[model samples]
Target: MHKTLEGVQQSATPAIRGPLQVYLVVLALGLTVTAPSRLAQVIAAAVFLGLAIDAVGVRPLRWLAVPVFFLIPGLAIILVTTPGHGLIEFGPLTITQGGVKTVLDTLTRSGASIIVLGFLIASTPVSTVIATLRRAGLPSVLVELLLYVYRAIGTVFVEAERMQTAAKARVGYSNRRAKIRTTKLIASTLFLRTIDRVTHLDEAMRARGYAGKAPATAEAESHGYGLSIGILAVLLGVRIL
Candidate 1:
């Protein structure tokens, strides 16, 4: 059973500094939004691409698909509907010069922003993100809410997945009606279980000393500030330039 016991052990992840990562994220987002020229936007895009490939690695493409979904629709709708003189017409569809420029500008800005933000998310742990939010003047209630939602969602998923798997084993979802009924049952069951779990958690917290406030979160490593500040300065400079 040595192999079984080994499989049960939780592994650790490398520590990333919380505040520094958050700072860079804010800077990257700010610059991405405010970048004055195409060249500046290109620079931001390059930074995002470089960060994804070098630091975040495999997650960028997968995460990027989410934003691209909305972005593509926005581009298509704008190009077809916006009224302007210069038309690049394709049958019933017509895109004006202004529409094309606006769409291109939007794509560059949004795609770059999404990539950099996704890099931040893929690299940082949840605990670090919560801690950063706490320190960044977010209300304690909101911070706790964020944490609670993350935890509760996981619990809900587990319950739902278990029920789904059990139904699948019995072929309870073999047909369309069966699938609909099973899904509703699964959702309702998950909702009830989540409420029960929250009640138990509340009691447990009262037993230990949770006086309606969130617990104190930890600070980031001392060394990360200088590097993070340097990065922020560069972004600000680029935005201005």
Candidate 2:
């Protein structure tokens, strides 16, 4: 993971502990989905966005753009396909009142969830999150799977960087045509290599007498129960009123 994406790894003041952080995320998500109106959802997202920025600065927020952009197509689909009083028309496509409402609801729900999860990743390394989940009695199989997937993503990223560097040295992207061809080749090769890598990893784990469960990590004491409680309370208040 990039350093900028890694949130405050360590803080002088005790922040939300691992378990508490997980609980807060769950609670926030629950509140977000059940939020009665867009205003409530927006407030929840705003709070999380503030915390994320305060933890890691604004640079990491740029990643938020990726998810938001993806949501655009989904929103467009909902706008055209949903049936209701016609609000606008473009040739065969018609935007309906129901569709607009659905889009706003979807946007708020997705935006809130994404921002909350983004804050989690920014504040803690994924390994720590996996460990926290394992300790929280998340199924061992699921925890192990998450750990391996995280490792695999890192491995793939490094491999892709090496491949790109090698390609650049060979002038693989010297022209527009070359760039497209190089990208296509790299993607296909990367997929094949990833499969091979996963196979080797599985073999290695078996060689080590891999059991159904991975070893549990030592518990690290964390604080911030009060802060978590406060945040959850505020969200509940907003939902109720």
Candidate 3:
């Protein structure tokens, strides 16, 4: 048990002990929004910086999917809603030069933000992030959920890879029937496994004296407050500039 715990700790170290590269990237992101008409240049710079940071091989790029998934669609919505002078009119369908510009700007800015966040996830460990969030005053239940979700994603991927490999071994790349069967197997397995895990986790938590309320730790509260203030200051400065 102790050895297993140590192994887990070692596996989690890359995320916890790295230089504050994520923080620096975030600071740069905050500065980019203030770059006036050079916004596109700033966004491009941030993206390159983030990629370079990831290229150091400390963090995997796949971890960035979460932020990109959320940011791209959000920017699209912002661009669609922004008011502008209509440049193209086709009955009710109008495309304004200003709207186009707004969309471009939003896309650039949001993409830059997601890149910075991706860099952070790549550099930081899931354990450290959970610790940070807990320390930052998030409820313990939420922190635990975050950790479980992280682990669950890894579980799902492993299941997927196994199914794919099995399919490939049986049907070479041409077996569409094998591919579909393998995919269904992976999906059904994940769903069942997830349900079982959630049930077991809930039971274990209850057995361990969990109640409806999450206990607050003083250290976590202080860290959360400090981080909240720092983030707010950075955002305010970005808007002001």
- Backbone clashes under 3 angstroms, per model: 0, 1, 4
lDDT of 1: 0.63
- 10 residues in a row with least lDDT, candidate 3: 216-225
Evaluated at residue 235, the lDDT of candidate 1 is 70
Regions of model 2 farther than 4 Å from truth: 1-14, 141-219
Model 2, global lDDT: 0.72
**lDDT of residue 25 for candidate 1:** 73
lDDT of each: 0.63, 0.72, 0.50
lDDT by residue for model 3 over 122-235, one digit each (tens)?
Answer: 444454555556655778787787567655544443444454567688774466776556655555565566557666766776788867433432212212234434544654
Report the Cα lDDT for residue 120, model 2: 68
Q: Which residue pairs in model 2 clash with each other?
A: 7-122
What is model 3's C-alpha RMSD? 8.5
TM-score of each: 0.60, 0.69, 0.45
lDDT-superior candidate, 2 or 3:
2
TM-score of candidate 3 to 2 decimals: 0.45
Please report the candidate that would top TM-score against the real structure. Answer: 2
Task: Give the per-residue lDDT of model 1 (tens digit) for 1-241.
Answer: 2211112111212122456766677677787788877666677767656655655444323534434644676788987787887677888878898888888888888877776665555555556667777788889888778667645644453455566679999897999999878766665566787768877877897799877665655446633566566656767787676
Higher lDDT: candidate 1 or 3?
1
Query: How would you order the candidates by lDDT, starting with the best?
Result: 2, 1, 3
